[model samples]
Target chain A: MTDRSQLPAIRQQVTELVLAGSPEHAEEAINETAEKFGDLAVVEVLGELEPQVASLHLSSFDGGKMSLATLLIPPKAWAESLAYFAATWDEDWIEDEPEVLAESLFAHIHGMVFGTDDEERRAELLNAALATDWGTTAFAVLFSTAAEEIIEIANDIHNLGAHRSGSTTSDHDVIPMALEIARTNEEGWDRILFEIFPDWRPGENELHAASEEESDDDLGDEEARESEFAMGRSTKELLLRLRKQVPSKAVAPAKKGARPSLGEDIFS
Target chain B: MNITSYTARTPQLVQALEALGQRADEQAAGILFDELCGITALVAKKFTNDRTAEGIHEAFHLTVGCISLAISQADIADTGEAKLSFLLQHGAEYVFQMGFRHIKELSALPYTAFVSDFDNDPFVQQRNLKAIFMEICSADPATTWSGDAVYQNEIVDRKRNQHIIDCGKWLRKHNAAGVVRDSEMDANAAITVAVLFALSGDGRIVARTAQRPLENLIAHIRDTKPDVDASWDKFLKKIPPEFQPLLRERMEQLRGTIVKKLYGKTKPKTLLTELQDHYIGSEQDIDYA
Candidate 1:
């Protein structure tokens, strides 16, 4: 890591770039840092700085329209981001890469999808997405924590399923490629799930208590279903089935935080 | 993983599920899954009632989730033509197959034609829905949070925090008949607390609470930001009189902590977060999607 003392200065500089300069300028600086110092440093600076940016929503609102949902992936940034997801569980990261990173990204009910649009309102809704920051500011808002599940969803869902009539992939194409590889990799699934659903993981105490409660015949079905959801057992089961169903040869996730594994294969 | 995970489906959907399995390329599976899964969110909202939004949300999520779980964990495909329009196309087809049956024009058209028509439907458009709902709430003289541009401004501007609070107020208020339904009263109360818990950044509001905590919170918010309180109208007023204190407590709790990622990382130590934690009247709206 760069000198720990220097971290705040880097954060302030990035925040200034995010607010004052074009998002491209801010992101370029972030990407440059990833190249020079690697993913961990940039992720660290971003995790600290995103909240600072969050504070400046009033300040960054206009530029953020362009910035929001715009992911700043420098090379294999997606793969490297996944690599650090597992690390967020480590005690050290809680200060910067907290566990709430794992919660299902769909907390707000309707935020899940854009209602279908027709020609007249299409431009209106399209402008709304941009105004809402489905661009660069969006990636900074959503992805800075390296929420793998949201990233995975964003790849296919087309801006969290807003279904803008002609929207395209927001992240580097390598993300979908990276997600496919990581999902197929045994360890990668663990890291991704660990990053996505920290509270629901099997070892959590509530599941154990519920499992003990399951012995009662009357409570059995309800508790079992609850336990299953809590443990992510059903998801694990479905994924196990998917392991057979999906045809990808498993490839490992890249090791460093925020690093994108931009293989020639990703390009092709 | 068991194909039987979803059963008793109509043959067409069943056939589609099986065909979906034919996707061997990581990219193809990912694209198909992303498309199917993304469209589900648009369709899922159709099924929401006051109470079961969470339950059905998970159900629709899992339905698409299991069929396409592999894509989330799999590979990316080579780029081709932008299929952005297909998302709305398929999304409309799926919702029509499930919803929009009531619209005469939509029902008469084939799925392709409905895509454009569906886009124009006010109910489906986010911008339209907010304006329509706000007009409903604002035009009604009987409702409480009425008579002001503040609510309209927030809704028009797409500031979701106030909109969420407004939803709780509306759910508690009387409907078209001007009476809160007995069946819905229970759901309304649950929504009140849920809204409180969500906005407050504390789960305790959802857990059963003693009475004193709430009264103190109402008093605190009233004292601290009395201007906001006048706007709040002890906004929980429409819910059961007994539950007002509970919702009030949450409205005052951690008012704008940005609950998901920022608070956890910086809440404890960073002065920046401390400043960020204060609630501005939500001139800024931050939706995760």
Candidate 2:
């Protein structure tokens, strides 16, 4: 790895490129530093200087489809920057190269900004990142944490309005990763349920019951009916099945300092 | 492996082609029929001079017809023209090969002509062509098939299964009357029945839920059929061995109740009178009964 002292200089160079309105150049500097120092060094630098790096925005002409503040700068620039940096690296680096280092670096930055302290913001960032097709490295970095952290992430994604339109990330993409983490621990289903039903709680059958009642009423209003129908029948059935699998006692109590449970609020 | 090994044996290919010939009665219309024509034309280009190519072409046509029929019969809501078109266009070669190998099994149905003759043939109604395709492909020698073909088939099978499971869940959620009235719902019911037959003894939990819809369907069949014994016999043959006895007992109970209600101690009415009296109730009312 590159010496720890060199990171400040590298960050300064990247920051200069960004200040010059050339994120493409900034990305190149970062990738070059990554190849020279290794992914860990690059991650450390990126993590420390995350706020400034994340704040760098591409020109509108550079296909600014994502949220302006997003880490996914234009692919062509990112690719060119990586290509230049990759040329300088040894051939040996190719064999065990982190293919999605760029995405991982961004994810780490996200982790730092939306640090573990604020559960809600952390989840929102994770979901938003996922929405933009975070590569395998990003998924590994974010989700390979503790089960409680994983559950919190799942709950935040499920409960928060994280599915920003035009994002490629889906619940389908997120679930299997969360489920894999959940499977490793005893309170796995709680995590799985948190991911599935945003407002899931022990012995709470409100959503299913409400859906049933809505279905029975005359569905003359097309928009309302369509909206109701959009809450997929199969999804409800799968939720019910998952609910059956979960023991009522397994419902995670409210976090010591966290907000009251959605279920508690509803039921009360 | 040599190119020859990749090519299917002549007999299997011929059998597949002959199966396609059986669907010649299907009128040329709709997206499926157009696809059948496109596939036939493409396959024909490969072996233009070979007389056997004609058979292969027919097989392609029949395979498409069978799928189209199966989707329509099963009331498969999601696997509409667009999905079929996408599959045919993207996985053209795999589909063609699959159709060539499995056309015979699909065409083995004795009533192919009868069913294909009508735009809305009840006899051809509600078959799970996706499951049939999966079963046919599953039996083929994996060594001879391309990885893309196998992977594509897996994707198709997964999507098809998910669709059926979704349909089953939807059916379970909604009332029979509200659901059965929709063409897609009816198709879903038929698909569920076809899936139940295909996946019998596979121990899928989703398959078990098919029982209620299947029971409702059997009742409908009983109401419609003039020869209940013949219809029941045909229906029972499709059911798995374990479920057959239970179904038979249920059917008998149903028949007995209908008989007692219709005949009573009064002079027995004609069969037509009984049919009119007992079976002429509204479709919605039948489920309640």
Candidate 3:
């Protein structure tokens, strides 16, 4: 086996290759390192990428096999450029030839959200993304993701709100599991959704709002744009189910219920 | 709302196409996801205006995620490469069109009556729930589908097994692939016939047209569960030195593509699949001649 100590130097070497705008070389280096150290070693090294220098990894990402590396790199630091973050997460971009596609960029953002086991780091990343652009703000993008996922997961667990026959029980099946899964993501979700994401209609940031950039002929009424943020009805139902079945801070209240009381007659 | 925008020019995809141009079939598989993305967008623009660069990108990711799950659970490879052929039969655009279609169905819930009054038909409920479930899964950072072991082993697995079987069988000539017990010949006769078939150029297993039959035989090997993995290492002792390379190369190829743990302790599994009748377009049939 190669000397274990040299791995740090190799990681540094790979970082330099990435900075030089030669992603292909970096990929080859990683693949070689993987053969010697196994995938986990390289994944650890890549995850330790200098957040600023490694930003070039995504910028220069092309058709090389470094798709995995581009995926793992942290977002460009806040001090480095909000414009860069805006470009990656912007809701209204129309590139003639997009160097980065929405799917890949979102995958990177998802990676950034969970990159550290540290809950505080995830919150910091989420907060920065939310603050960067009002157009399809980070909250909207992540909520849309959570909304779609909740509906899908509900199908497996809810069984159409009917109890299963014989040995099956909802206790064994969905709720406890949902609560546990909700807990697994203590870093992101629940608190992040409820606390940081107060506005569904964060309104258009200068970058992603199209009307300001486009001519008047392309204009539509404010009503059409506002309608997009109403949230999908089925998604709303699933979140409701989640809040009811497994209450947590990650869950958002679609509409606040009547004020609570110790007893039904207490308020009366 | 789905992110919707369009760009006719995608330089990264263009680069993927050019890179694929100089690569081998083995190498091409690695870049297939990227290659499919570009091809899907180009093909999709003809059919719908709702697509955004982001929508198409995410749609393909979901579709491939479903495909990967099917592949992982299927008795596809030491089981057999039958499923990969199953993949190859469809034009890339067709697979992607299914994905874009899924995106539309997500909010519409067209198949399920939005009214939650349970349908009297249990199968209808199963169909609708699975359809909804496919719309999300463990791959998403957003969902908790992977949290429960019972949900996976007891509930989700039945869905998994059926999906790959459907994919594995859907494209084959209806009877060409199946359980080994159904094979018409006994082992000795099958061996003789296989040799004779190889002697005849039209029936050679290595030819382009024999893709289905070859996959079928591999499926049979998996089902039959011959203790080949135990014997595979020792068998090399009997082979003449000159031809050993050929046998090793062939085994390696199968290991890389279809069959798994070839010389290991376990019996392999087989996979199959079906296409929705609606996915078929009238004019798109290939000319067999």
Candidate 4:
């Protein structure tokens, strides 16, 4: 665990070095800046970056581990720089969704140009930026937009509670409950999405297999067995029906007995 | 007195009518009269594009106002015939709009569509309403967009009991970060807020004044000087010990040049400039690997 007090010094060094020029010159400026300002911005930004590595905390009892990741964006006045470069570099593509790509590009430049002090953070941020189609803006937009919409919904529901109440109803009771639902649905969506599909897009096959595995892990309870069967039956029915309707190029074998039979497997 | 006659006479009663429609106990005639008046007021606002007290008395019926009238009749036994006739004529056209869909669905319910008071089964109505919103929003991507696309995607992504819990976790992280205050958020509240936020594409949650200084500092990292790992560490320390490593690990894995690209700015005076610079983009070179 790192000490939080060191942040101020690191922040100062990073600030001075950012003002100074070039990676080569940065070392000297950072040192001087650190001595003068003590752990300023430059060092804070550049210091602890580790390459493509993260810590995973494991349960002492189960030895189960979970990966902890990082994303580091360096501070620089590169917004205009990135926008201009993107605009001219790919004029044809710029019109497609400039906001999306600009966000991605700027995010990339920020990380690479300013660089990370933490090696692990540096690697993670850079990697994530490169790996994901959209960059920080997408994330920021998603987060902020979601928050705003939720608040609006909550306010609307609250207003409805107050505005729509009858002789028997009290405003206090209805508003808070409606507000709570609006809030829950808003926040739960992202967490659920990320948890289920960390990759952003988990295909149906992968999704099914994951669910099956999850079900299998639980030794057969009657309810679990029945639910799994029901799910499997419904999924099969959906796939078969879809295949028939779409005239699939590929054939899927219908499962015997337990699975719904689509006569003359279309994919075949 | 016939409710429709009253509604026809008093045009400004739609809001009151809608409010009356919410309650089971309201004298059906009185409620109907008030709702018609509210609908008239609404129509007046629509045609005039603003409200005038006298315009509220204009008895002219818009398509939606008619449907609302019909749907209101769906509730009462005595007025069902005349209202049904009006609805049958225009309900198809009116139903195309979202507000009428809400009216139609609520009218179909055994309980009044709009509830005057909070009930123990508030979740039932809330969920039903939310589902209706989702349907309306998702009807056509071009015509109607989900305010909570990301959230909907999550639900559609997987079928799991744990999804609810997982959503709570995501909401908590987002709620605590930058300009978002602890007072403004809790797990349940965060989840609801996230859903609404996702749908509308508006990010404002808590007031800027309500946020803590450390929260502001974190915002600086995310928007202006993004050191995801560092910020993660800084944030994690402030959070409960159990959550620190979890958040830290997530941030660590999310790092890279792209992550760097997103947030590495050095503004001397304030973090806002750096955030804006990134938001707008800079005239820099692209480094693709």
Chain A TM-score relative to the true structure, per candidate: 0.25, 0.32, 0.39, 0.21
Question: Against the true structure, what is each candidate's TM-score?
Answer: 0.17, 0.20, 0.24, 0.18
- By TM-score, the best candidate is 3
Per-residue CA lDDT of model 1 for B183-286, tens digit only, reads: 21223233433443333322222311223433343444334433444434434444566556545665555345432222234323342233224422121113
User: Alpha carbon lDDT of residue B24, candidate 4?
Assistant: 45
Error of 1 at A183 (Å): 56
Report the Cα lDDT for residue B167, model 4. Answer: 39
lDDT per residue as tens, model 4, B20-112: 355443344433333334444544554333355544433233423333433443443434344434333332233223234443344224332
TM-score comparison, 2 vs 4, better candidate: 2
How much lDDT does each candidate structure score? Answer: 0.34, 0.38, 0.38, 0.33
Off by over 4 Å in 4: A1-104, A107-115, A130-268, B1-66, B69-289
Regions of candidate 1 where Cα sits further than 4 Å from its true position: A1-48, A52-268, B1-11, B25-28, B50-53, B58-289
DockQ of each: 0.01, 0.01, 0.01, 0.00
Let me know the DockQ for model 2.
Answer: 0.01
Candidate 4: give its CA RMSD in angstroms. Answer: 43.3
What does candidate 3's lDDT look like per residue over B87-127, in tens digits? 44443334334333333233233231112234435766556
Considering summed lDDT, which 10 consecutive residues are worst modelled in model 3 chain B? B274-283
lDDT (Cα, tens digit) per residue for candidate 4, span A40-120: 343353434221100100001011211111122232212112212222224334434534543443344433423335645
What TM-score quantifies how close candidate 1 is to the native fold? 0.17
Fnat for each model? 0.00, 0.00, 0.00, 0.00
RMSD of 1: 35.7
